[model samples]
Target: MAMQGTLLEFILGWLMIPWRIFVEIYRHAFPPANEAGEHEHEGMLDASSGDITIDKRELSHWTKLSQQWWDPEGDFALLHGFNHCRIPMILDAYSKYIAQKPLPDTNPLRGAKIIDVGCGAGFVSEPLREYGADITGVDMVPAVIELAKAHWNERHPTEIGPDYLCTSVEEISSQRPEEFDMVLCLEVLDHVANWKEFAAQSCRLLRPGGCAIFSTINRTLAALIIAIIGGEHLLRIVPMDTHHLRKFIKPSEVEYELNKHGLVQVNLTGCTPVDPWARRPRWSDVSYCGVTYAITAVKRA
Candidate 1:
């Protein structure tokens, strides 16, 4: 009976797939374009002015898997609202990183030239534009880029909507050098094999004294059990094997890499996502020792 029920559910889910795709496509496509007078073609900057180009791609299989309804681990329902339960965590970290500045606003990132490297659907970059920044968000997958652009254009249109790019880091770096004031590399290092190369290209994109922010889970027993096993296996919050211990980096290693490239660590903070099961955030959940961390570094003046 259980096996029969499972098959029935699968057939029902398959029937719903096309409707979901159509709804998703409609939501992504029509968000009401800005007034024609307000429309500014972002990528075509004159040589006299600094121009920033962007590259974007689709979300990874892990991300796509996480977006489906059947994937109870998926946050597609929550994330589409741009109010993922993690927003508060990200906002709190951004607040402290700026040192007493208002959360997400009143920061130098606003209206500044910014690059979101490995930006997986503009979770950080979209809100960063709330401060008026000329933002560009990039990723490795065109699908995720399309989703990010769709969200930005339709749902979260800011005073300055961010530019979306579908390309690799090397491609963007080769095209636009020393162009951004802030480069964001959030929650991406653990997924990247050539982290050192990614770091170098991030620093290269920033101007002198510019800042870059990066966040990722550290490799540790606690992380494996909590972030991977508990989150991925037990609760099904994040996609399985989406995080690998080998790719995680310690704070010291990150500092060393930045110093090697003339980028100095300016600030560091820890982040812990609120457990969906937990009704509210707790201090016990907060710790600097965990796998999740955020760091801000500046290019040497």
Candidate 2:
């Protein structure tokens, strides 16, 4: 059995050599540009000018999947299962760092205002709302926002739920600067054209001392194989082209951007699937972050 396992490992390692070479060539051919020059040549720069983070390609891809946003057994099942771990991380961070008080057993987040950036069909927003949070779910995709609203309405016929908006985080920050207790940008950092600008705007939306939570896949060869090749191609978990290689940001890069915007890192945790087939993620150590990770930061007072 040991010999067989070793042979399998050797075979896999040999198979990955070609992918490693391709990654190197891709990186060298299209070297990451500085923040000022990033995506300028690709015609990806949004005309809206100041801190516009929307990527048209990404928008179109998500728009096509808007109808499947709430399907637990469909394309986004991995994301739906992600809520189990991310929700607790959000609550723990808020209670420990932002709230600084022991929360009540019921409605722990009662009266807490949260902005769910890139909130697709209210997946994260709906759960947080159930915990008594006042959530505003913002997404650039119109169809998903509508779906979110319809789903919320169906779920709560007598009571209102999260405020679903069809807009960008930059627009929201401009209108309601420093108003929220928490800003969540889960699975969104890699999708934006300009992550620095997106991080800045996300931080701007938070009130002083408020928490900002972000989750994204790391830029590494492991991520390339698992997230893009395996998940998108072999397993067909997420839609094709849902992620791009060049857009994935490293954890250190995220911390640097958030720190520049006056947000201090409080916690960083890695998340990965429980198994290849199940695809359900669980919180793990930072060492496992070569694939996917979540970070919590607090804006300075």
Candidate 3:
């Protein structure tokens, strides 16, 4: 009887395993409506060509990757994370840097020119306009640029249109070289296929003494587990392929590339992790915030 009971218990446990896995997947994929709905916005349409403009062949793959990284509600979530319900953390950091002193009379825009590369949804760039900065925001995705335009329009109803362009960094640099006082490529370097080349192109766009800020995940074991396994498979918080380990760059590696392109790192900061348990932001270094790293660099003369 003891042997028979043991066998039955083993069988029961084996049978329940699949159900447990299914339940876990369901919970992660579909969080409670109340929680998910909190991020939802009223119906907004893309003003740039109602249809997405990338080539059809590349559209599927780009869209798949984009669906993961480009959260339709990222602006809303970022506002909640950074203690400022108005702008993104990156922009908040820049604004804080500029607001340190009074703006110079000769130069407007907080005494600096700014360019926000990969300005997804204009979360970071829009705030700069209020400070009187000549900010230009660029992104490759038409759908995303459209969304950013719509958001910009809604926010600045009385102001002139945003200086937003849709193209790769290299393409833009080829057309207009040495133009910006400062360039921002936050959280976007890892997404591109050839970051070294892209970084070089980004450098060419900057004027002497101009600054370019960047943020991305560093390639490491912790990054892979948190960004891919936990973020995509477990949490279902971001679409799969949002972070490709092979494309991720280490801090030293980025510094080398920037140095090669005549840019030098001025500052570096570790970001606080996003708390899944609390469903909010928290100050931690456990790679819980998907191992993201932020860097500020200046162009060589």
TM-score, model 1 to reference: 0.67
Top lDDT hit: 2
What are the root-mean-square deviations of the candidates from the true structure over C-alphas?
13.1, 5.4, 12.6
Task: Sort the candidates on lDDT, descending order.
Answer: 2, 3, 1
lDDT score for residue 239 of model 2? 62
Q: Please provide, for model 3 over 177-212, each residue's C-alpha lDDT reduced to its tens digit, 9 standing for 90 to 100.
A: 888877787767766544666677878888877777
- Tell me each candidate's TM-score: 0.67, 0.86, 0.67
The alpha-carbon deviation from the true structure for residue 235 of candidate 1, after best TM-score superposition, in angstroms, is 0.8
Q: Candidate 3: which stretches are off by over 4 Å? A: 1-111, 274-290
Candidate lDDT scores, in order, read: 0.59, 0.80, 0.59
TM-score of 3: 0.67
Model 1 RMSD vs true structure: 13.1
The digit string of per-residue lDDT tens for model 2 on 1-301 reads 0011245545664566567557644864676554346545343554446545777777788888888777766677778878777888888888998789888889999999999999989989998999999999999889889999999889888887999999888888999999999999999988887788888888999999899899998888788887876665555566655766777889999999999989999888888655446644443334478889998999999
Candidate that scores best on TM-score: 2
